[model samples]
Target: MRLLLASLILLVFIPLNAQTTRKYSNEFMNIGVDAAALGQSNAVVARSNDVNAGYWNPAGLINLEDNQLALMHSSYFANIANYDYAGFAMPLDDNSAFGVSLIRFAVDDILDTTQLIDEQGNVNYDRISLFSTADYGLTVSYSRNLPIQGLSYGVNAKIIRRIIGDFASSWGVGLDAAIQFETDNNWKFGVMARDITTTYNSWSINEEEFAKVQNAVEGQNQELPETTEITIPKLQIGVAKLYRFHYDYTLEAEIDLNVRFEQNNDVISTSFASINPAFGFEFGYIDMIYLRGGMGNFQNELQIDNSEQLTFQPTFGVGFKYNGIQVDYAFTDIGDQSVALYSNVFSLKLDFSIFR
Candidate 1:
């Protein structure tokens, strides 16, 4: 465990050549996957004990009790954008696990108006066309025991793909490392390092499409766009605990500190890094029916007088489990940004042991 921790630290802090950190580059992946997580403002790092762990905290995958499959779908901005996810995970043995996850977010049916004014400047509605832009993430993860009871480590290999109809596309790769530890008292702690090695995306633009758009307007498309994008490393630290009101009633609460290496709108602002804290809890009756809620994304908004006032996003959700199948729902904000649109998210999980 000591060696593993040391290596992860080294990788996270190591300097890279030509580092190009940008705000919200490949940001779609951060929108989150499962609805249970979205409800808690993505604070499930410490207790994600199922297939969904592949994205939250891979180390938690070690806690899975059976082979599992998961699926989710969500829409944002009045259904203009759609997000989808799918994952599969299974325990390889008593001390190890493996999982794979795929996520996609897209905006479709966008009108292309470049050719609207044909050669003679005639108003031709028939020239209008449609296109779509999408972003995708694929992650393969592995978790293993750390030779210490209740302690485990995990790693993820990721592939990122972005597309804009036939005009442009990009491909990138990155890595993540995480750890989770549980105590006998039902206290769980976890840390996840996202894009720990710095992710890079190289884009290819279609000159044919560029020419059409450039000629559409005299003053536009004057220069070639930057084809490279970079995503800096981020960290999430979480702690959670479970309490029982009785033999059949229970509650679990979790708190997470999400950190980004660059300053942003987080309430805890700093030039080096900013921190956002999220709190969430779940109440369960026999672990079959559940209710969840949370609040997060605190920000200091500048008012008319330049004075800052605090604001936060609130979320709610409900879940049900029966016969090895579980369904969850959440009404929450899209990403950590204080977007007013609260999207509805749904996810399904199935345990393969039911077949036995």
Candidate 2:
């Protein structure tokens, strides 16, 4: 473990410059909520050691000895609360590992309102109405070590749902895959692919909003219209490398590139390709205390339209381990030098194990 700690310090001070390019949709709603999944966002990723390897990289979990479970939460930008993730892994009798995990992203108490206009095209504030929105996802995953000497693999399937303030509710499915390679020298290589389907669903406007708008149309007293389908983002790919230092510390770096491709590629915009690069260091004292720091692009969106508004240039976190259990936390801020939408985020995680 001391070797892992040394690697963490070396990577931070070494100043090795690297650049990554990726394709991603600059959409605000999608980016803000799923930020954590793009990479191993919690400090627990470091403290739990190889327990989260199925979500981060299945191959990494191959080296684990204890059975474990964990939960994590993120306070997102724009007054939104992101998801919670839980995972468990156990060692088989033949030196193999098996694990399962569930992930859920949810938001509550969102304000739903409508635009009010006066007859003379002036302002009308008295007519505004309020409602709320809700979105959630549930993912289940399984992973195991391969018979191959140094390979591991895992997969996750999910169901997603969205409701926009008495408007409409939509549902969709998603899948994620991960693989990892480890060498005797404590070096590891990993890859993950997420949202392979480019999930799609639709929601109707709030009933109140729809009625207000419909009534405003000069001669139309029409019935409420049908809901519309909204498309989410597309496939995302991530690659990472880890070097273990002395003790139980590690230095890891990863890059995630996402792209949006529709059935009609000709109309697709080049901006669909977006990228996020993560460089992080984890320090562990024995098998318990941990400290982490990382810097990355595309961690959060500060502006609704400017994709460059991705904040979280640097992040720091800490974790505690006791009796085969772990707790983690991370803090992030958006140095939005140019907008009122500037914000900060906090995340927490807990891990427990039942040895079998």
Candidate 3:
């Protein structure tokens, strides 16, 4: 009971110190994968138990009893962008495990208008071209059970790459660590430190092309500059509980709170107004079929006058498992009024130990 009380206190107190800011970089890394987790509004820090744990909370990988592989694909942001993830986990022993995952988010075939005009100020249709923008990350993760019962820890080392067609590219490396505790009475707590190394992306531009472009518009007051970006650290805390009923039915509820520390106007500080919280619920029958719903991005709107804030978004998902294989689907609202606001995600997971 004391643990429950502590969890409640944390949920309420953490966001009070959150302040809003917009100086952080690498926003694409914040896009979550896994249909099941997304369906639950990404409140999986304490509830992740499958291969997807490598991306959500690596410590959760300790709960897996078998080797597993999972893949996910989604049509994001007005259905014009593609986001995909793949993860695999292998248990080394009863107390340790290793995992790896890859993520790619891309927008393809975007029209390049920079070179569409000729020197005579006439539009050259033949000069029009297409290019792509992509972000990729490869993560290697490890997890192990601690000497203390019900406690576990994990870490993920990641290599990140971003490309703007062939014009510019950047590379970065980062680390993430997580710890989780599950009590005997079905309560779970999790904390994760993301980008512990303050991932830095050093960009390199094509100099010859860049100079020509600079000379092309020398008097027009337009210029492109190469710069480095740093991804600030984000901390996440989560709590969850599960209940089981007769006939193999189970229900679960989870909540996650996030805080980001970054340089706001050249001074490093925590943005108290940027505190985001997510909530999720799941129902399952005999571990075969599952239903989930959640809400996310609640920016501490506790007052009545601020009831119409746009921070909250609804998410839903469903899953089916049979013969060691699971397929899941999720739908998310991207916070827009148009039909494009809705995005669809699909995922498949395979457990290989079941066959062996």
Candidate 4:
């Protein structure tokens, strides 16, 4: 009875902060990739034109002029969780490009307390063990120009693998499609269909390990555990344009709309689909130094009085590019509508043509 009561208490507090499989399946993949993109609140769907575009809007990969490599790292909750990304892109021909990207999000050194109690019903600190939970994603992307001038299309095939120590594991697969069009005036339009085929994950749980957890709880035993998760498709559309000024100054501004076919807490919701808008802009000096800012992730939060309020996230960042090496940094917050928790993100991009 003591272990059962203690396990019930742990259940209420532990899983609340851990990765869950119920809703938002494969959510780590949606955390965004590059620092430049996240710095601008992921409003770069129309202007992603380098290696990082492999995870943003692959169609923009068609604009790659030289082979490129990108890497980024970010941590959350005072280094409790870590997120990392790496990508490579190259122009295959004058009108085609190819890229590949890898992403990982993990929380390590978690204590497993299910076995902390001995057979004599006494607390045994030495019996506790440590474990980790991690998720990984690998994406391969390709883009090519269409017969129509200034029009390009792209596709992505994604593989998802997840592990929860020795307790559970899963494997998933998904596909994405995207298109980009540029007008004579340098205006760009882009659309991306994420998980167009409805990604599916099949879980495999270790019965022996799970039995320890089951015995700890009071009445968690069920006939069958959930073994599958499905991720529905979503759409993102964006428009952007660049402005050139005297003395080699430039400005780029973009807006993106994310659409999901379900009722949620998005800023714009209806019986059909909900839409959330993001706005971002970049200022450049001589095409070498850049300043970026954005606002996004608008949601309707309920208050104590049952009233709803609109809230959003704001971000800013800076970048320097010299001799084919680019360094970027962003001050970000992932808090939706609660107490703010801020973190720092850094990324680097290398242009292989510089060495050649």
Candidate 5:
């Protein structure tokens, strides 16, 4: 009970900080099969490769020499659901590259809502229900090298959509921009701003049925039906620095802070802030295999408030590359109190590149 109360207090007292809403869109956008494998940390931005660069730092694509394509899939929370990602990058010239990517986050069958009444007051009969929520996006990006120094910049435009049941669907647009710089000492810095202009179209509310139910209980007749178009705010800001050490080993750290801003969106209810800071270290062995591990929202720092609070635990993973192909995986444990989740998350990623 004490833990529950603390969770509630933390949820309620938390102030608005991050500036985005429909976190599902953001989460769905960030999910990566290899992101976990590379340290489950946000710091990998400075170590971008040809394929994963689409998500980490599109600017990194300028470093690629050949046309490359990659695909990745992840099993989230063990079996509760899954996400799939695919991308392709092609070098337009020595200093520029273009890429496109698709991402999908899907959950399994869920209980369907059925209206019911019982003699005991108010209740509904439990029945097997089927439903699912999904988010997907298509992004096109271009990256170019700056002429003055070891710097690069890139931009991506995304088409986003979400589906909930047969009656509800929302669509929106978002964009991301990134900058990267490297130094002679093997130090790198990266900055990214994502979802700069994201907004949802609107959701359906079955006004006729809602009115019938409301009138039956309140004994009041309503003449007009109104629907609300809720606008979720755009999010901003992510930065990271990476340092190379000895023995082909490197350390990278990243911090991402964002907020959910929405009005009339019941799921989120109120404005909330989240700070996700992660650290990762990657070591190369024989110049072919890479082992990485990191912790996120370190120590259950990221929180969501509702009747039940949800907190994420530290996550870790690793990766391997050989003969122009890279394979990655990650593991995550939600915690013990989670009813539907305890030990969960098995992810896999594949990346390929060719040099000209």
Candidate 6:
């Protein structure tokens, strides 16, 4: 455990200059997965205990005494995009566990007008084509319970791939480390380092595929170029406490703070501002039914001008469990960044004890 902690510190603080111009490569990996976590505004780093913990805080896997499988689907931007996730976890020994998960995000049937040209001067609709863009990730995780009664540590290795209509593609890999602690009084704390080794995506472009577009436009001399982008490391901290009440009811409240390290290109700002905070609450009855709500993406008033406004994305969800099976549904307001649309996520999970 001591060696693991030392390694995590070194991985996070290693000196690597980040690219200033290229930002957010393979961003699909940042999108939160699973209805249960998204419903809590992604504030479950401290409370995650299901198979989805492989994506949230891998250290939470130590809390799982049973083998579990989880599957989720979410529609974004009013059905324009689809995001899916699947994960499985199993206890490897009395004090250690392993998990694997896959994520896919895709946008299909986009009209490709780059080749819309004909011998005649008139535009030809028949020349138009349709294409799709997709991103995929695979994560392998392992967790071990420390000698301390309530402390656990975990690590994840992830591979990412992206494809754009058969014209371009990219591949990358990264690492994540996490630690969690729970007290006998029902208080939990967690810390996670995302992209601890820094993620790098090397893009390969096929310039020949865009010859038609270059020919159709006058004075167009641009060509696709191979490039690489780096994703800076991010740190997340969370704390939660659970309250038990009469009638077999329990309530949990949590808050998370996320800090991202990257360049601030705004000429007006003197330094980088990369802090984001979120809050979530959940209520459960008989440990079978749950209600959840949360909010995230908050910025200080000083960060915005008169022309710009801050928007808070709110989320709500519900869950049901019966006979070792669980189903969850979540609704989120995606705001107007792209399209004014709401997102709905649904997930199913099954659990069975390995020892039994």
Which candidate would rank higher by lDDT, 1 or 3? Answer: 1
CA lDDT scores, all candidates in order: 0.86, 0.49, 0.80, 0.86, 0.58, 0.79
The reply for model 3, stretches above 4 Å from the true place, is 1-23, 211-219, 262-273, 300-310, 336-340
Return the clash pairs for model 1, or none. Answer: none
Window of ten residues with lowest summed lDDT in model 6: 6-15
TM-score of each: 0.92, 0.62, 0.85, 0.93, 0.69, 0.87
lDDT, model 6, position 84:
92
lDDT of 3: 0.80
Candidate 6: tens digits of C-alpha lDDT, residues 1-356: 32233233223312244332355565678888778788889898998877888999999998887899999999876677789999999889889999999999987777666556677766888987777777899999999999999999999999999877656778899999999999999999999899998888887766666455456445745444436767778888999999999969999999998777753422122345477788888999998999999988664333335454455668899999888888999988765223467888899999985225
lDDT for each residue of candidate 1 in 1-356, tens digit (9 for 90 to 100): 32233233223322233243433478888888888888888889999889999999999999988999999999987787789999999999999999999999987777777688888889899998877778999999999999889999999999999987677788999999999999999999999999998898887878788577557656534444557788899999999999999689999999999999988889898999999999999999998999999988888888899998888888899999999999999998754356577799999999998998
Q: Output the worst ten-in-a-row residue range by lDDT, candidate 2.
A: 18-27
Alpha-carbon runs more than 4 Å astray in model 1: 1-24, 335-339
List residue ranges in candidate 6 displaced over 4 A: 1-21, 263-273, 300-310, 336-339, 353-356
Question: What are the RMSDs of all candidates, in order?
Answer: 8.7, 12.6, 10.2, 3.9, 8.2, 9.0
lDDT of 2 by residue, 94-154 (tens): 4466666655544455322234666677667775554434456555556567877666776
lDDT for 221 (candidate 2): 56
lDDT of 4 by residue, 1-356 (tens): 33343344335323423343444478899888777788898999988889998888899899999999999999987777899999999999999999999999987777778878888999999998877778999999999999999899999999999888787889999999999999999798999999999998888878887788777665756333457778989999999999999968999999999999889999999989999999988999987999999999999989899999999988888999999999999887896635688889999999998988
Best by TM-score: 4
User: How would you order the candidates by TM-score, starting with the best?
Assistant: 4, 1, 6, 3, 5, 2
Q: Which stretches of candidate 4 lie over 4 Å from their true place?
A: 1-23, 222-224, 336-339
